[model samples]
Target chain A: MSQDQKRDAIIEAALKRFAHFGVAKTTMSEIGADLAISKASLYYYFPDKINLYAAVLLHIIHEAEQAYGPLVDQEPDPFKAMDALLKHRTEFIIKYYNVISFIRSKHDIPEELKPVFGSVHASELSRMRKMVEKGVASGRFRVADVADMGSLLFECLEGLRMMYLEQASSFFPTPEQFHNLLKREQQLSQIFFNGLTV
Target chain B: MSQDQKRDAIIEAALKRFAHFGVAKTTMSEIGADLAISKASLYYYFPDKINLYAAVLLHIIHEAEQAYGPLVDQEPDPFKAMDALLKHRTEFIIKYYNVISFIRSKHDIPEELKPVFGSVHASELSRMRKMVEKGVASGRFRVADVADMGSLLFECLEGLRMMYLEQASSFFPTPEQFHNLLKREQQLSQIFFNGLTV
Candidate 1:
């Protein structure tokens, strides 16, 4: 395999192990053994366990971006685009539920992952802004300040997630809890979007 | 003083000490010292420090209720009432910030305060329901499910607060952070209420 392909292979292997056993319990040796690669090669690629974990998170983010980035143009209707985006986000979060659970705890966030998370946050905000602006351009949304409204909407949705996160007893939320959160998001999003509708 | 007055006095004294020094540092002896009452008298009123802390939280809730209860009728407009209620809620949070900070940390919640906090939470939801119902009755709010919307709004506001609380470096939020939270609440609240308005 090419160098880039080998790195992707390593990340894929590490993601499964980390998701199943959690970051702390899953070690580099186990990951290397899973891929039939030597520990020296794994270390050469990732340097450490934290670096591999950060790469996994970054990989998921890239996957989510690829899945949802075209939603604005594909959907045409801004309202529909936003709804689809949120649905994609929900699915992405649940798909990587166990991996995401590490960040929810707040204490386990690795230093290398902070910038990855920060960039991801900024991109999410920018996406929301673009959606809101699209709606305004289409004369469907009656927003005064598109950027401000976008940030407010994003924060409200985040608050909804945080509400459920706080209520869950375990790091990973139950499916039912995730269901309740999605319902709240839909309900809240409907009302919020209606307010913006002209 | 009568028994009731004595208990209130003890709760009042403990509030000041706990707010300034936090629950970990403040002791029953210091509370009694603040009130010039003996430790025995303090114990008579409150079985232990935990009980006293719970009472203090309850006291503040009662104070907030008394301060904001009439806004639904007093403001004459549902939108205005909610705005005033949210404003009062913000002030109440900032006013008793240090004490409330204890709850934000999550791990420090006293066992005795669980029921008290639960009841306080239920009452807050009930109050929100009442306001939304009043708006619907006045033909101002076009809500299909009054109870659901009320709960959704309350949860959204809470999410806003939690967002900032999670961002804070210390147990208590700084003034600027609180200001930003209030701005987000107002912005989000306006959109939410507009969506509900007829």
Candidate 2:
């Protein structure tokens, strides 16, 4: 494999280990072994565990963007695009809540790594902004500050994610319960969009 | 003082101590001493520290309801009432985030005491339901399930509280920063209300 391909392999392997065993317990050797590479070779790509973890998070973001990017581009209705985006985002969150919670609890993530997470959030906000702008342009949505409306919608979704994570232990113990919660969230998005459109 | 008056004093004193020093640190004796009552007498009203803590929480809920009840009832516009309610709630959460966070992390709050918290949340949801129904009745809002929309709004506020607490250390280090967050939350509520109203 080429150098870049090897690095990508390392990240892919590390992500699975980290997700399964959590960050603290997952060792570089295990990640390297999964890729049939030496620990030294892994270090050549990532330098340290934190770097590898950040890379894994970035990879997750890239994957999510890839999944939703086409839907955002092709959906003619802005509201429907938003609904798809939020549903996709929530599904991703539910699937990865354990890893996400672990990362959130760990305060040791480097300041430099923050932008990796921030950029993903920024990208999501920009998508929402574009949707609102499109709705306005098409005379479907009211004329308001596109940025503020986009942000409002983004915060609502953030709130939903936070609530879901908080209640995951007790309120949403069953998959059926979680599925119901998502349905309610979809209904909420519809109401919010209805309020925006003429 | 009358027996009821004495019990009220104990609850009031306990709330102050609990709010200031947190539940684990506050002692029943200190609460009694603050009220110049015997520890036995204090226990007469609240059998244990847990009971006293629960009572204090109930008191806070009652105080909040009293503060906002008039506004919810007297406001002519349902959207305005919701805005007032959310703003009031966010302000309360900001003031009590530390206390609330403490209670949440402990996770030992008794099952019986669950009703105290649940009732407050239910009351808030019911208020939101009433507002949505009012808006729809007046042709101000699009027809939607009132209960679901109310719960959605309530969840959004709950999410805001969670996010604020999570970001308190980094995103909101100063009172001014927290104030700006509240202002942004208010703006979001306005947009949400605008979407609901015709």
State every prediction's TM-score relative to the real structure: 0.91, 0.77
Worst ten in a row by lDDT for model 2 chain A: A100-109
Count of clashing pairs, candidate 1: 0
CAPRI rating of model 2:
medium
Q: What is the per-residue lDDT of model 1 for residues A22-104, given as tens digits with 9 covering 90 to 100?
A: 77788899999999998898899999988888899999899888877876556667778877877777788777877777766
Q: Indicate the residue-level lDDT of A19 in model 1.
A: 76
TM-score of chain A of each: 0.90, 0.82
How many Å off is the CA of B82 in candidate 2?
1.8
lDDT of 2 by residue, A86-153 (tens): 67876776665545545543234487578887888788778878877878888898855888877777
Question: Model 1 misses residue A22 by how many Å?
Answer: 5.3
Show pairs that collide, candidate 2.
Answer: A195-B195
The lDDT of each candidate is 0.81, 0.73
Candidate 1 residue-wise lDDT at A15: 92
